[model samples]
Target: MYALIVIISIIFFISCLLFLDYQLGKRNHIKNLRFLDFEPTTGDYNLYTNGDQLFTDLFDDLRHAKKQINVMFFIVKDDDISHELLELLKKKAQEGLRVRLMVDRIGSFRINKATVKQLEQAGIEFTFSSTPKFPFLYYRIQRRNHRKITIIDDEIGYVGGFNMGQEYLGRDAELGNWRDYHLRLIGDVVKDLQITFFDDWYLNTGESYDHIPEPTSEGSKEVEITSTDGGQLEDVFMTLIQQAQDEIFIGTPYFIPSERLMKALLSAMDRGVDVKVIVPMKADHLFVKEAGLPYLSRVRKAGGEVYFFDLGFYHAKVIIIDQELCDIGTANFDRRSLFLNKEVNTLIFNKRFVMDLRLAYLRDVQDSQPFDDHYTQLFNLGTKIRIGLAYLVRPLL
Candidate 1:
């Protein structure tokens, strides 16, 4: 009995430690917040669509880099674009370009040892996130560096849902299609993204940068950085969504936003704001779809517009408020993105960018199927019950 009590006590102690650590860590993170300095800078910021177009723009910006090129991604596959990018990096490195690359271990499984060796041979610096034990610290690693950031000369930056792979370049013969949203910001926001990359690099390499550069765009950018854990801007995002006065428009592939976000949407509708949401007709993850449907009732009742895009897969995470503020990044509307996955998004407040992003959203709407009144009739009682159960676990998803 004493042995059992001791064992139970040990278990209880570990649980309490983890809980306290998690909470205390979050508070510490809040104190050292990143978004407190987000203000717009001067530059020609724009909203871009499609993987190929985004890559083209990124490569163009990279070519214009005078000092450094840093990239932190989750996947780096050996497809057509990946190979081409590697070749270009090699050429640029031969020209003495300071190039650094990092990929997540789980996200880049298809990238074998040979490709890594090639990058090394080309004098490119590389790092891997989440090493498993044995020689590595094995398993139990949950937090992923899911941030998508690319900084060139510490001047131009790119962030969004696009990951490294054949699909991003739209050259995936297996799937035959890849749809995503990546933004190009030419301002001080790039500096914040650069800092994010530096933090990840230091996490694995134990090295620090001498001087983190600032955004060089002409005007200012009112952007905020949010995370799933400590230094969380979940409340910040929630506040922004709830505060929408005229119209609230969002496009997300996965639509499992937290209850707070859902309530904000419903409240927006209640106040007679035109609330609009665009989600994939067929999501890459099915359970997320199951979890998202139940929220539609309140949304529809509040007179919101829900749209379902039908072409290929609509994998864009975007939020536009009153056609003034726009958000684009890897964070989906789901809890996984909010509290599980490492996501990065940028909020562009310029009216021109908003108009352009709204046009892009409307262009996507052309290929979309509107989620109208028929949805409530589309699913039966059994489905609703299961989805409700699925939603209960949203925070941990």
Candidate 2:
């Protein structure tokens, strides 16, 4: 009995230490935060809503590259579209142009060895970011490089949620229509994206390339690029929610938010701020979709509203506040994106741009099916069991 008591005491002590560490870590991140320094340069941003147009524009820009091409994606499937892109990179590399591509290993597990060999034989530099080895495989598995960025000649860049897949083009009949958001930017913002690609490329392959092109004063649109490798992103979301005055509109495919974000959203709703969230009706992961129901229920209980996109899989990560600020990027509302993955998001402070984004959000809302009390009653007993199981393994999802 004495030994049992001693073991229990040790376990309790360890739990206390862990809880303190978690709290202190968050506080440390918040204490070190500083106001973002916005770039004084201007840029032109073209938003692409459909994947067909997005990929077309991306490939066209790649074909026109004169100097070099830097590309990174979370998923690169072994399909016709992937082959087409691979061939384009090969042709560019063969033409004596620098071409480097990085894809997350786990996300692109289906990419066969023959494709990689082809890339190597053609002088195209291809590498996988955050591949797991023998040791610490579990630890490495959770930290994914989720950013999708393409820098063409250091003058033009693209960033958004669209990945390289046939489904992204709405070709998968099961998944149906694929709706997403991507931005093609030309100006100083390109330099910021280039820096992010450089850092990731060098870390993965030990290859170093540094180039920052001169920014052309094209249009007056203020934006800031925020990149996070498993730190401070939660604080960014919390800050944005706190600063919101009138309303906050968030659209993300995933809904497993951190505790602080959940509290902030609930508080905002309690204060009578219009807070609405749009999530995909059919998510890519079953566990994530099941796990998110509770959070949606909590938000709804707090007077906030939730909508599920019925038209297609809404994979865009966007947030707009009071029709004044807009955030669009690769980050999701899940803990993995906020505290584990390498994500990039751009915060735009231009009212006109925000207005356009607001219009887009309105369109999405029109297409979405709002979740009400009736929706909760539709969940059967088996689904509720699955949801409980999903919540138990939420961290991994």
Best by lDDT: 2
- Candidate 1 segments whose C-alpha is farther than 4 A from its true place: 1-40, 132-141, 171-178, 214-231, 380-389
Error of 2 at 341 (Å): 0.8
Candidate 1 minimal-lDDT segment of 10 residues = 133-142
Give each model's whole-structure lDDT. 0.72, 0.85
lDDT of 2 at 165: 87
Candidate 1, residues 1-397, lDDT tens digits: the string is 9999999999999878766655554444345444334444344455667787888878787777777788878777767777777787776777898889888777777777888898888888878875543321211143455778888887787888888667666565544455678877776666777777787787678889789866556446555544333225467568778778998888887777767778878887778889888887775654677788767556766788788887767778888888888877877777656654566777666787788888888888888877776666778877777788777655544
- Supply candidate 1's per-residue lDDT for 54: 82
Poorest lDDT segment (10 consecutive residues) of candidate 2? 29-38
Clash counts per candidate, in order, are 17, 0
Tens-place lDDT per residue, model 2, 1-397, is: 9999999999999878655654554454345433233354567789988999998989999999999898999999889888888899999999999899899989888777888998989998899987865333454566688999998987888999999989999998878898888999987788888878878888788978655666554556778888887667888899899999899999999999988899999888878789999999997877888899999989888888899999978898999999999889999999888876888888888998899999999899999998997888899999899999998777666
What's the residue-level lDDT of 325 in candidate 1?
80
Q: What is the alpha-carbon lDDT of model 1 when measured against the actual structure?
A: 0.72
**What TM-score number comes out for model 1?**
0.82
Residue 190, candidate 2: how far off, in angstroms?
0.6
